[model samples]
Target: WLLFLGITLFQIPRIASQFKEENWHRISETIPVSEGTMLLTLDTQAEDPDFNEVSLKIEGTADSLVTLEKEFFSRGKTKAESLENAKVLGYQVSVLDSLVSFPPGFDYSAMDVFRDQKVNLILKVPYEKPFLMDRSLLDILRNTIYRNGYKSRDVREKNIWAFNEAGLVCLTCGSTTDETENQDPNEDQTEEEQINREKLDSLSRAKFRQRLDSIE
Candidate 1:
């Protein structure tokens, strides 16, 4: 006797279309994430955490990558297999060049083995209201690689994701960049002039506040 099992895989186009519809609000806004949006929550107290004192974890894995650090001209990179043991706001990241040694029994010629597989970076930031700026961090990483004359697809890949409380997860890829162009000629003023202006503004504000406090 022979038995046959029917299998159906979800359609990618449908999934993508549904996602766009669901996130239309975010996609339409010039600045979807507000300035005060919580990017990461640094809790100093958590029991039996991987880092023991602090742990860094993201809400999703879409922002995870395995990439080379040198290719990015980045100085911050460290090896990490689990966010459970990472420090919150940690700068030590993992790079691809350093991960040449895979675990034993793992075949490098596997079908899903992305040639640039090692050039991936995974960052787990705490869940915050704004998680990050309006733009994703992956864009920034890609731009940096491109600016350095390195083909992003050939070099390393960077992923920045966020995680929130209640064990919810979300992932994203690429970095973000400000699209705003300065219209004010003063925008390019000398650093000294800008510093002086800021100092004067602070002094004036301080005087006004002091006068108001006295009346109260």
Candidate 2:
């Protein structure tokens, strides 16, 4: 390695130009959306740091297909060489049934040299489709607006949200970012609660008077 480094120093200008990043390749794929699925969960955990960085974006689409897009970059003497180098793909997507276990980043450990390879996942779905975002997706979800003025990360993980024309919206009470429109837990009364309230109110006159006298 040292000998190669020393040899390259003799022709720094020519060698450096040979390794300049000059080309990028793009790819896009679409998949059909499954039926009867309402909830989508994102895996919060990230993959190994050594791998190339991958970014994710999700949006509501009138169309029923989910799209995955990627851009791979490489340094080469010619455009064809760069294209051929970037053609080596190694990432995988895991979207089975309801539970999502996909890795959060792209894997590039097997590849030689550093190629500015990037992957962008575009999950398209109908409006009002519910989802649970992991805290890790904050970087990708910031652009998305939620019902009211709540930030995407501000909503709790347990809370479910609907991705609609309006953006990310809280579907449940606990998931709301603000106190507005919050209903009181005691506002609704059941038969047992009514009976309990009546019992407390209908104290005997003598006992009520005695209690009042004691307080006085």
For each candidate, give its TM-score against the true structure: 0.19, 0.59
Could you say which candidate leads in TM-score?
2
Worst 10 residues of 2 by lDDT: 197-206
Off by over 4 Å in 2: 1-15, 18-21, 31-47, 139-152, 173-216
Question: How would you encode candidate 1's per-residue C-alpha lDDT over 6-75 as one tens digit per residue?
Answer: 2223455543432231100000101122232233222222122221121121232222232222111111
Expressed as tens digits, the lDDT of each residue in 1-216 for candidate 2 is: 999998888789776665665576777766443543333444556554444655566667665555556666666667776676677745566666654444656666665665455555556655544556656555444245442345554545566554444344455534344554532223355667645533432332234345447779
What are the C-alpha RMSDs, in order, of all predicted structures?
Answer: 20.0, 16.5
Error of 2 at 202 (Å): 45
Candidate 2: lDDT over CA atoms? Answer: 0.54
Q: Which runs of model 1 end up more than 4 angstroms from their true locations? A: 1-8, 21-189
Give the 10-residue window scoring lowest on summed lDDT in candidate 1.
22-31
What C-alpha lDDT do the candidate models reach, one value each? 0.26, 0.54
Clashes of each: 32, 0
